[model samples]
Target: MRPLTNTPTRYSWATILLHWLIALIFIGQLVLGFVMVRIESQRAAFELIQLHKSFGFLLLGLIILRIAWRLGNKAPPLPPSVGALERRTAPLAHLALYAFQLALPLSGWALVSVSTLEIPSMPFNLFVMPNLPLIESDAAEGFWAAVHWYLAYAGAALVALHVAAALRHHFLLRDQVLTRMITPSSAGE
Candidate 1:
């Protein structure tokens, strides 16, 4: 087999941009979640939640673009040392991540839409977002809430694994798997 030293293995420019942007948004969401939900009385907590929701919507739209980009462009292959089991599971895990990332945000968005009370204030009073149009029932609202929570839990769990696996590749395997995303080659860069 060919050696996998520093071989360019990363998404296209657009794909990488989307990947990093979503990551940043997710990080913000995680922090906002801890602060807003945990310390309920803090000033600006509601606003922070709105910020989180808006970022989630951004992530939702970007995710669709990311999926479309993935379909169009061939993704870079796994690095040299990735086990066969990991190679297979990576795609499935990504699939799950994308699904959850999209579902949870959209569900939360829908919850706001179906809510009887005034939706929390967001920037510019442009807070209300478009709904799915199909899922308009109160039951659907509850269902989406459940989906939002469960998927968020699953996504968080997977993120831990994702980070651990990257660490494994970086420290244990001494491979360039993490480097691929971190530093693209001169060609890709």
Candidate 2:
């Protein structure tokens, strides 16, 4: 059985779980966001938008926990096959991912908060989530909406690059970069 914490060569089960869960939800949010805007039915679009907001809040919470966990735990090192330049840039790339992951949802939250419609965000109908204490006006709403839209697209591009890098490490480099994330480290065994 794999350990709950990170191993020298493998990720902890918790890390693996959070990684995939966030990835899936983020991807779903992107798809839902695009489709919801283009929806012809007002009711359908509103429903989807609510769902998207709920998922965004959920993502926000999970990411907070993920960041906490990551800070507490040390990551496994890259294999020797990786070049020095890649090694240097990998941390920056990861930092960018973390930043985007945090920023995208916050932007969405800001967008909803400043919306002139004054819609209350009830995440999964659990409770009414309060909006950020930002001024509410059409201009504020439009600004945040633009920020959210641009961030979403930019974050998607970063995610694509991240995936390509992982695939390159796995297929071309023939290294354990991807597998370590997929499975537990075999350091002890």
Candidate 3:
């Protein structure tokens, strides 16, 4: 059986699971965000938006856990073939990823909180989430909405870049970067 925690050279099963789970969910959320807005029916749009919010909340919690896990564990080192620029920028890219992962949800929450519609967010319809104490106004809502929208596009770009880089490592560099996440045992090969 696969190990539960990360080893010195590869991510543990838990980390791999969380990483892909967050990636898939975030991608779904991005697609949903675009599609739901184009929905014609107000009722249909509202339902999809609520689902989006719930998923956002889920992403928020998962990201927090991921960050905590990363902090507590040492990530496997980048391969020696990686250049100095990549080594320097890689951490910055990761930092941006974490920041966007966090900022996207909080901005969404803020957008909903200050919305003129005053719609309460019920994550998965399980419970009503409390709104932030910001003064409710059109300006506040617009600001948060803009923040949320822009951050989402930024996040999409980052995800694309991340994937491209990983592919480069896998196919071009012919390194263990991608394999380590997919098959931990391969890290030792």
Best by lDDT: 2
What's the TM-score of every candidate structure?
0.80, 0.98, 0.95
Model 2 RMSD to the real structure? 1.0
Distance (Å) between predicted and true CA of 115, model 2? Answer: 0.8
C-alpha lDDT score of every prediction, in listed order? 0.69, 0.92, 0.91
Candidate 3 accuracy as lDDT: 0.91
lDDT of 1 by residue, 122-166 (tens): 533576565545445677667766766676777778777878988
The whole-model C-alpha lDDT of candidate 1 against the native structure comes to: 0.69
Runs of candidate 3 with Cα error greater than 4 angstroms are 185-189
- Could you give candidate 2's per-residue lDDT for residues 29-148 as a string of tens digits? 999999999999999999999999999999999888999999998998999899999999999998898888899999999999999899999999999999999999999988989999
Residues 116-168 of candidate 3: C-alpha lDDT, one tens digit per residue: 89889999999999998888999999899999999999999999999999999
- After the best TM-score superposition of candidate 2, give how far the Cα of residue 13 lies from its true spot, in angstroms: 0.6
What is the clash count for each candidate, in the order shown? 0, 1, 0
RMSD of 1: 4.8
